[model samples]
Structures are given as C-alpha cells and as structure tokens.
Target: MNGIILASILLRIAGVGYSLVLLKRSGDRRFGFFTVLLTFMAARQVLTVAGTTGTGLEELPGLVVSGLAILTIHYLDRYVDEEHRIKRELKDTNEELTIFKKAVEHAGHGIFVTDPDGTITYANPAIESVTGYEPDEVVGENPRLWKSGEHDQSFYEEMWATICDGDVWDGEIINENASGEFRWVDTTIAPVTDGGEIEHFVAVDTDVTDRKERQLRIEDQNERLGRLNRMNELLRDVNRRVVTTTKRETLEETVSERFVSDPWVVSTAVVDRTASGRLRTRYVTGDETAIDAILEDTEEAISTLTAAVDHGRTMVSEQVKALSNDDITGDTVGVVPLSYRDRNYGALVVVTESSKLFEIIDHELRTELGDTIGSAINAAERRRELVDDRVTELTFAIEDADAPPFELAAATESDVHLTRTTTDGDGQRIVFLKVDDVDAETAMTAAASISNFSDPTLVSAADGACLLRFVASDTLADTLACHGATLEALHVESDTGDGEIIIDTPVGNDVLPVVEALSSRFDSCELVGRQEREPTIDTAEGFRGELQADLTDRQLEALRTAHLAGYFEWPREHSGEDVAAMMGVCQSTYMQHLRAAERKLTTNLFGDERTSDRRPAVA
Candidate 1:
C-alpha cells in the first residue's frame, strides 16, 4: 500500500508539470482552456488511482474528464484551420482586383462609367488624353458638358433612352474638348446591369474627327462635279443653237434667258466697241438701272477690258467693287476674252459672289463659251456682207451704160411684149424702151431715134403708127457732146453717156442741183432718171427721149414682133425650146438665129465703143 501511494503521487506531479508545459506552448487562450481540462483530467486520474483499492465511481470521473479534454483540442484545431482558409481567400481576391485595375488604367480605348442619368462615375486616363481634360475635373459631371451643340438635344435624349432600356447604342458624336474645340467621336454606350436591373452606363469612344472632315470634303467634291456636269450640258446646247443662228437678236435673247435662269450667275453683259472705240453695252441681265450705271462708268471698264483683249489674257477683278461700276457690289468679276482662231473679238464680263465660285468654273468651259459667242458674231457679220454684195450687184446691173444688149429675136421667139430700144443707134444704153400704149409708140420711137447717136438703126412697126430704135453705138466724146447739148437747154432729159460722164454725175442731195443747172441750159432735156453706181457691176445714166425711129415696113414688123416676146426676164420666163417652136424652127436653129441677132444689134448700137474701144475692161 505504501508503494502504490508513493507511485501515484509521483505520477500526479509529472502530469501537472506536463500540463503546465503544454499550456505555455499553446497560446494564452488555448492555455487557459487546456489548464482547466488537464486539471479535471488529473484530478479524475488521481481519484481513479486511489479508487483502485475501493469503488468503480472513481474511474467514471477520470473517463469524463479525459473525454472533455479531447473535445477541447478538436475544437481549437478546427478554429485555426478556418482562420487560415479565410486568409488565403482574401489574398486571392486582392490579387484579382490588382489585375483588373491595371487593365482599366492602361486601356487604349477611352472608357467611361456613368450613372443611368449620364453622370460620369469614373473616367479612365484615356479620357484626359482624348479630351484634354483631367480625369478629376470631368468625374461626377454630366457627359453633356462635352456636347458640341452641333447635334440637337434630341440626340442626347435618344442616347439616354437606349442606355436606360439596357440596350447598347453606337453612333458618332460631335463633342467639345476642354480646349473649346470641336471633336468628332465614334461612341458606343452599353448599360451595366445588376440582377436584371440597369445599374450604370459605360461608354467607349474613339476620336474620329479627321475621318469626319475627310468625308465632308468628299461630299463637297461630288456636289461640285455634279454642277460641272450640268454646266457642260448647258454649254453644249448653247453652242449648237447660238453658234449657228445668224440673228443677233436671237442670240442676245438666249444669253439673257440663260443668265437670268442660272442660279450661279450674279450678272452678265455683252460689251462691244463703238465706232469711237468706246465700250458700249449691247445686252445685259440683272438690273437695267445698274446696267445704266455701269455704262456711265465704263471708261475704266473699257480700259481694263481693252487691255485684257489686246493681250489675250484673262482678267479677274479681286472684287466687283474694284470694277469701275459703282453700282456693282460683289466679291469677284471675271473678264474672259472672246476669241476665234486666236483673234480677240470681244470680252465677256461675269460677276460672282465669291472668287472661289469663279474658280470652280472650268477653264475649258469659259474658253468654249467665249469662242462660241465670237463665232456667232462673225457669222452674223458675214451674212450682212453677203446682203450688201447682192444689193451692190443689182444696182450695177441696172445702171451700166455699156451693158450687154437685150436680145430682141430671143424675146420675139419667147413671145415677150416689152419693146427694147437704145439712145440713137448706140447700144451703150441706160434705159430699154417699153411702150405701154400704142398711141404713144409713134412719139416714143421718134424721140429715141433723134436723141443721141453715133450709129443708128431704125425699125418701123408693121402698122403705120410706130417705129423702134434698133441699134446705137457712140464714142465717149460723142456721148458727152450729146449730154452737153441737153445741158445747154433746160428740159427733162434721159440719155446713155460715156463712163467718165456717168462717174462725174452728182447724186443724193447734190443731184437736184445738177438737174436744175442742166434744165436752165437745155430746152428739150429733162431729168427723167437717176443712175446708181455699184462696185460689182458696170455704171450708167438714165435719159428721156424726144425723138423716134423711122424704118421700112419689114424692119418695123420684125421689131414689133421681137418686143412682144419674153426675153429680158432673169432665168428666162420661157424655155428655148418653146421660143424655137413659136419661131417655126428647130431649137438649135432658133438659138443660132438668136445669137446672130444679138451680135448684129450690139455691134450696130454700140459701133466702135461696143468692145475694148469704148472703155477699159473691168474684172
């Protein structure tokens, strides 16, 4: 028994020491809990050792204390494992946040987070780079601060509507930078959602100002091209009509209409040099009063245009105010020389609102229009020249004294009823006699035969009442002597005279003086006809006859028959075949007779003056 008590006491002491050591090694909280559990277990174990000699109740206490100690150790281990797991999860979450933040800060695109109301929640550094604004300055501000006002308020309203509806919106936006400059941006706005509810808005933007500007420029160029095409078509139509028409009035009207109808043309006018070399307005569009003002101030305009045309250069006035016209107000005036084949004909003055607008008119278009107007003017002038030529030719044909004879035989064969005669027997004649009444035929024949003659031939009609002057030819001296005879006696006179005499004759307002002067000198001489001299044909004088022809029955019969025939009409009123048939002969035979008759009559009437002996031949 003594040995058992001693061993138990020693074991109790060792257990206490071990329990103290364990409490110290475990931390303070675990230490207090372990001390209590170990003390209970030690007391139970001591009791069990002492009860071994007595009841089993002592073993039960020891068992309960040991079970409590095991439960405390297990709980402490679980607490420590739970704390370690929480720490590891916290570390992983922090690392993920660091990576996300790094990505957001360094992103290339401008990222902005805003409330559903468009208030900026967060702006990345890219926002400052793109907008020239500090992130802090823009944060918490409504995105509308960047609105350029170029787009209407409805644009922003639509954007908000899309974002609030949880839909992504993408479009271009014109926005103002912090520098107060406008910038175009391509933006995408997406709604941020939490549990099916919109929580915020996110916008991704790209600076697209350069691209937008380029697009606008392209559109402008296309519009200009369209305008150029229309101008080309208009020019072509004008060319076809204006260049071909000879009427000056038509061309002027067309130009006026075109100028008034064109939206781009501010004003237009045609200026021409007058006889005095001063520029005169011929046609104008815009305001007539303004046109008058321009004309009044045209000394300088004329000077400028003359310089341009003389130099064959284009003159562009920096502004219309620089032009001489005080009434004209515009930014630019274009003076284009109108020319054909390098010859300057005129100048076209075009006024415009802008210099750039004038520049837009293609060089080829101006050149073509200038040439067209010049050519039209040239054509019109040429037509006038032709008409003048025709008139000149007709006057000369009527007035020439030594004109080719009217073929009486051909006239007779053609059944013409006009009597043809000459002064005396000289065919150098001004007037061809045609008797309207047979009662006057005798007096007319007698007046023509005795009038003035170097060579004379008389043909009496088949009836006893009339006679015809068949042929007459006289020299220039003889003709002039006859003219002096009529001039010496004041009387109504008509006679074929020398070329020099006809040239010396007076005309126009001077003619009546000549007639009066001659009437005071000659008795039977009266001024009966006036002669017209023209460049293209021969010249002659007209005369009044007071004497008639005396001839045999057969000669007078032939003369009357010839006078009844159509011969003197231009392009012949009767055909040669018909004339030959009327003459009772073959066409060829009758033509030969007609030629013979013409030679005989011309030679007898003109005599020595019929050919080169009379006057020098003219071209």
Candidate 2:
C-alpha cells in the first residue's frame, strides 16, 4: 500500500507540473481547470501516504481528484494539439505576406493602395519617380492632389462610379506633378474586396507622357502633308484652266468659280481697278454677302485692294465681317494680286471658311497663283488684238549710244538703216541692215565691236552702201514684239548716233506698258510720236506696180521677152540671142538687163539681203 501511494503521489506531482506549463502556454480555461485537479490529487496522495486516512476519507478525496484529473488530461491534450495546428497556419500566412510586401516595394510601376474614399493609404518607392512625390508625401492624402484639371469633374465621377461598383478602371490620365508640369499616365485601378465589402483600391500607373507627345507630333506632321497635297492638286487644276481659257472675262469668271468650287472656300470675287480709280467687279461667285460687305466700306475696301494691286502682293485678313456666317465664324479673307511680269491688272478676293486653307495657301502658292492668272489674262488680251485691222503707230526716238545699231553707226561714222528682221528656228533674230558711208569690211568691224551683235557677216557692198547680216538679241524689235507691236522702220544717224523707231500695233492696245518696258531697257528712249491709221489697199496689184517701178524699161523688156519666147525653159526653144533679137538688143546687153532684174526681184522676194562671194577690205 505504501509503494502504491508513493508512486501515485509522484505521478500526480508530474501531472501538476505539466498542467501548469500547458495553462501558461495556451492560456485556456480548460488547462487551468486541469492544473487545479492535478494539484488536488497530488495533495490527496500525500495525505493518504502520511497515514492520515480513516473511514475512507483520504481514499475518497484521492479517488475523486484522480478521476477529474484523468478526464481533464484528455481534454487538455486535444486543446494543445489544436493550438499547435493554428500556430503552423499563422507561420505560413506571415511568410506569404512578406513576399507580397517585397514585390510591391520593388515594382517598377507606381503601386498604391487607397481607401474607399480615394485617400492614399500606402505607396511604393516608385511613386517618387513617377509622380515627382515621395511615398510619405502621398500617403494619407487624396489622389486629387496631383490632378492637372485638364479633365472635367465628370471624368473623375465616372472613374469613381466604375471602381465603386467593384469593377476595374483603366485609362490614361493627365496629372500634374510636384513640379507643376503636366504628365500623362496610363493607370489601372481595381477594388480590393473583403467578404463582399470594399476594403481598399489598388492602382498601378505607368508614365507615358513622352510616348503621348510623340504620337501627337506625328499626327501634326501627317496633317500638314495632307494639306500640302491638297493645295498642289488645286494649283494644278488652276494652271490647266489658265492655259485653256482664251478671253480675259471668261478666265476671270472661270477662276472665280474654280476657287469657290473648293470645299473650304465660301466665296470668290475678281475685281479690276479701272484707270479712273474705280473698282469694277469683273467676276463674282458663291456668297455675295462677303463681297457686298467688302464694298460697303468703300474707302477701306479700296485701300486694301489698291495695296495689293500697287504692291503686287498677297493680303490676308481674318477680320472680315461679311465673310463670317452662322455656322462658321472667323473666316479668312485673301486678296491675291493678278499681275504678270510686274504689270498689275486686278485683285482676286477669296473667302475661306477653313483655317486649313490658310496653311495651304502659303507664300509660294499665293505668288504662283497670281502669276498664272496674270499671264493668262495678258495672253487672252493679246489674242484679241492680233486679229484687228486698225493700227496704232508709235515712233520712239532712241538716243542711247549703247544700242547696238547706234553704237555701230557711231563707231563707223555711217548711217544705219534696218532693212528687215527675221527669226531663225532657234528663235534668234537675223537682222539685215544697210550701212551707208562705210564699206563691207568697215561695217563688219563696227558690228563686231558691239556686244549685242553676233556672227556679223558682210552680204554685199556697192555705191557707198554695205548690206550686213548678223544675229541680234534683245533689240528694239524684240522688245516691241514682246508687247504685240511690229517693228515698221528703224534709222540711225551718222553724226550724233541718234535713232528713230516706228512700231505698229492694233489700235486699242495700251501703249503705256510698252513705253515703260522700252524705257526700262534703254534709259534715253522717248516716245516722240503716236498715231492711228487705216491699212491701205496694198494687195497683189500694188506689189506688182512697185516691182515694175524698181526695174528700168530695158530690164523690164528683156524679162518679158525672155518669158514669152521660152528662154527661161529648161530645154530652151529660144536662146538668149533669140530673146535679145525679139527685144531689139544685143545678147550681152539683154543678159545684163536680165541678170540685174533677177537680182532685184530675188532681193525683194527674200529678206533685203544680197550675198556675193567677194569680200572687200576696209577702205
């Protein structure tokens, strides 16, 4: 009995110590109750072993305590096992959280967490580089701190609505940084939900300002290229119209209509300033309101138009009230000068509703279009003058010693008379001139000294006159021809090298432009005379009379007799002697008369240049 009691007491003591440890570690009420039961059993066992038991009292206490302890120990073992399982799960959860936190901290893109109200709760280190703000500064602040205000309130409202509904929101946002510079960010925001309740929101942002700006620049370049192409096509069409139209009025009307036909142009008007300083509307198309507006302010309108015409420049205005409409306001107005080779004829008024047209019609386009229209109008006017019969004669006294003809005459001390002027296939002028008081060699030497004369060749010389042929460019004849005038007669004096020129044109053509052009080329030129005259009845009959007068009676008789007797036939039926007998003259005399007549006729038929093989030296 003593051994049993002793063993029971030792075992209860061990149980009590283990139970206390369990209670401290688990802090469970069941382990505390088990510890109290184990202490009672240990004390009861000690009492029973100390010989203090009677009437089964000690045994009873020991039995009850031992039974409670055995039951508590069973429950305590289960409690301890359950606590160990929970500790293992907690360790796994903490390790996973550490990995996620490190990933968020080291991410390249800005990662941030916000509460349901968009207040930033946490931000990664990358937020400093992305938003120009440190993580600490962003935390506990509203995301609106970086708002650039480029977007309206509705933009943020819509984004909030989507995120609040637990859906992801993705878009590009323009935000201001700490430095007050706008930045473009591609952002994705997702709601973090816990058990069907919103906990927080997670946003990942990428800085995309550079990429967005580059895309915008590319789009701008492409738009400019497209506008340039459109302008080129329109210019080509205008050029084609200029080439085909033959009347000034028709060309003006056509050009006005063509400009109005463009989608951007709302109206076009062509106006000519008359010599009396009056504005005459030549051709008008599209909206008449714009043109009426321009004319309403007469002084201002005239001033603007005159500036373009006088200066021969393009004028653009954005403040024309008449050009504005209900649908499109601030229309652009352009006044393009119509001038050719420095002569102003009119101005073309254009009203455009598209700003792109302003960009398209740059300086180059304006100048080119003005030149095309001016040239076309000038050509059409020339075509009209060509078929008229009434002639205007202009006589200009050219005293410039620099003129090639005057220079040659002054150098050789001779009178130079231009006989004829013709052009070769290369468009170079071939001039035939008779130099009196100079031999063929002296005339050639004088011509060679002039810069305007080239390829001088002596044709023939006889009786104090030398006929010379040479190539001359930019002479009085060429200048007059350029202005639709024909050179009628030219003469240079020997003593003073003074010269007179006579040019003829259709009666209605303007002589001022011609005179001005000539004056520009030769400084000492003066218009000494101008007259209108009717063409004489100089037909074939008159030509025949002139030819007869050029020949003597004997020469005429020889030529007529030879023609009637077949002396000119290839196999002559009558010889030169036979024709001479019919004409009552010797064969040698008849041949001499015939040869002289043939020479004169050939000179009249061709240009007045006669060629001979012999070249005479200067006298």
Which structure among the candidates has the greatest lDDT?
2
lDDT scores of the candidates, listed in order: 0.53, 0.78
Where does candidate 1 stray beyond 4 Å? 1-121, 132-183, 187-204, 286-311, 322-331, 341-344, 353-357, 390-619
- In Å, residue 600's CA in model 1 sits off its true spot by 25
TM-scores for all candidates: the values are: 0.40, 0.53
How far off is residue 530 in model 1, in Å?
Answer: 23
Best by TM-score: 2
**Cα misplacement distance, residue 106 of candidate 1 (Å):** 6.6
Which stretches in model 2 have alpha-carbon errors above 4 Å?
Answer: 1-92, 113-117, 164-167, 191-202, 247-264, 274-276, 284-288, 294-305, 319-330, 384-619
lDDT of 1: 0.53
RMSD of each: 19.0, 10.7
lDDT (Cα, tens digit) per residue for candidate 1, span 327-438: 5554456666766664455566666556655566656667667777867865664565455442111010112222212222122211111233224333355232222223
Angstrom error at residue 369, model 1:
2.8
lDDT of 2: 0.78
